[model samples]
Target: MQTRETFAGLSDWQVGLWYALVAVSVAIFVWGALRLVLKYRRGRGAFPTDNLFRRVARTAWIVLTHTWIRRRDGVAGLAHALIFYGFVVLFIGTAILAFQDDFAEPVLGWDFWRGPFYLGYSLFLDVFGAGLIVGLLIMATKRARNPARLDYGRVDGVGSRYERWRYTVGDWAFVGSLLFLGVTGFLLEALRIAETDPSFERWAPFGWIAGQGLQAIGVDGETAASAHFGGWWVHGVAALAFVAAIPFTKAVHMLAAPASVATRNDAARNRLVGLPPNPVPEEIGYGVVADLTPAHLLQLDACTKCGKCHVACPAAASGYPLSPRDLVLDLREQAEGTFGVRASLGVEPLFGSDANLLGNPIRPETVWSCMSCMACVEICPVGIEHVPI
Candidate 1:
């Protein structure tokens, strides 16, 4: 094994890059958080209520423990649970690095990853990364094979090719990214260990097989060290790309969810009354017609597209005209179309009303299809308020 050299500290460029990443991530996360805060504050008038607390508690339990999911989905539910929880634990690994590289190593003589902490940290990184990779692989297989012996109609009222495509392909990319992170990270760690301690081959359970195979090829220790560094670069770049992609894709929910939960209001569970009619007064409007308010559009962005919301609507399950999943996607689709237009265009039609300026192709039946069961609200990890106001 090659002699190992550990950097006591980062170079100026490394520190600069680390700070830049932190600054960007924090800025975006804060922007998303503030948006939710302003939304709830204005919408709910800053009043607190017991009803709100109870509803939040219930939703939190369902999302955090995934209890509703298990009761409803069984094996598929467990797969999702593993992925969700595994990512959380994996995030802790990054947090430790952030502190160590950005703050601790500069101020203190040592950082967190020195002795006991390093041991425990390494163990957690191995377990959580492996768990995430395995769980993702299982989900990928299930997406392709759907071995639960149930069809789409049995679970929800109906499923379409577009729906299936929406689900499986994007899911594969996300899962594939996670698996790649795990494999590259493990190999990188193994190489570093081999450089420092030949016996490290015994402790690293996940990558020892691959390491031994390379060793058997009589690859010189210097070459193996180079490979390890390359793996480190691969893992780091992949992780960064994954982070950036979160804000633009379904992964956005990872950040949006906590904000939503933290900022939910008292009336979130109750069915949203359609636009109020004031005969003698100033204004009359129906529910989300042409232009989705920022709150409504936020709800769409927060959606995981996991189809959990579809199970909440009785109409969707009973073969009526509503699927909460489809409703949200439609909202997003139309909103994307209307992005640059001024909000003054009046409400768009959510249903069939040509006379109304706000009406769109989103049908009245679909709008009315909700049972107001709050299933979407309950299952949503991000705390999206699905009940129309």
Candidate 2:
């Protein structure tokens, strides 16, 4: 009696249609992810497997604890932790619901999503849902204030100036989308509670309170039902679209960041990577995109454009052209154009096979500007190996 109705008012055909859309979303996600993997594989050296298990465990600990994210700005670190954990809990909640509907009750005949379990689940999700919104607000506010770190202005000014603004738009759109999803999620829950006004629904504290407000405003009965129906579709579609777009968008950091952290040489600053037994002139340093190691390629995507590296870089501080942040970004643009999804789409600044990174976009002057200072490597939250690159 205390459980939710899966797919509530939808007919059999509509439910089937929803599943079809989910399939399309998942297929696109997988394809985009595979494309990224291939793009990384196009690089020179292989992904490191040395001490992988220990490295992975360490990565998980670091990522879960948000240790790297919180280093310079405690507020941003807290905000990120809130968003990360909230999304995780909400994701698990959705999975649990799906498993019960699609497998447990129907196939195993063990329906456990009721009573105490349902109550606890509702309360957990409600709290995290609110947390997600709060975290997004803090981030949006930080961006609005135009802090020095978050500022995307170009000091080197190699590529199109509009490129930086496009990145700005993408960052805002990312935050906006997550914010929109969080708000609509609560609204959906509120609408549902207002429609039925069930006593058990009090477990979802935020939704319950919002539902009461809706009822106070005379949004109940048929009006609530109509709104819920429309909203369910809206939220469902947006959620699916967000999932499918993750790998193709800035959200790729969700995957790339973890991999970058895991693969990063913990002692890189102290013991720089040794040169080849006898290096050729062509192999002295990376001249082209293909010469970048797989870890470097992955690091390019792992960058959140946080600018911590830029701030910490001595080269940048001295007004040199070498912003480690900009270097990675330029490499990223080149990598994407050469081998990644942007190449497939024929986006501007497209690179051909063996495209010379040092030729354009990345200037030889910028490379020379670096003093091999390890500040960028040390301060990078996502584990980009700036000194090595």
RMSD of each predicted structure: 6.1, 1.2
Task: Give the range of the ten consecutive residues with the poorest summed lDDT in model 2.
Answer: 154-163
Model 1, 319-343: lDDT tens digits are 7877766666665545433431211
Candidate 2 pairs with clashing backbones: none
Clashing pairs counted in every model: 15, 0
For model 2, residues 66-125, the per-residue Cα lDDT tens digits are 999999989999999999989999999999999999999999999999999999999999
**Total clashing pairs in model 1:** 15
* lDDT of residue 337 for candidate 1: 37
How accurate locally, in lDDT, is each candidate?
0.58, 0.89
TM-score of each: 0.72, 0.98
Residue 378 local lDDT, model 2: 84
Point out where model 2 deviates above 4 Å: 159-162
Residue 263 in model 2: lDDT: 91
lDDT of 1 at 21: 74
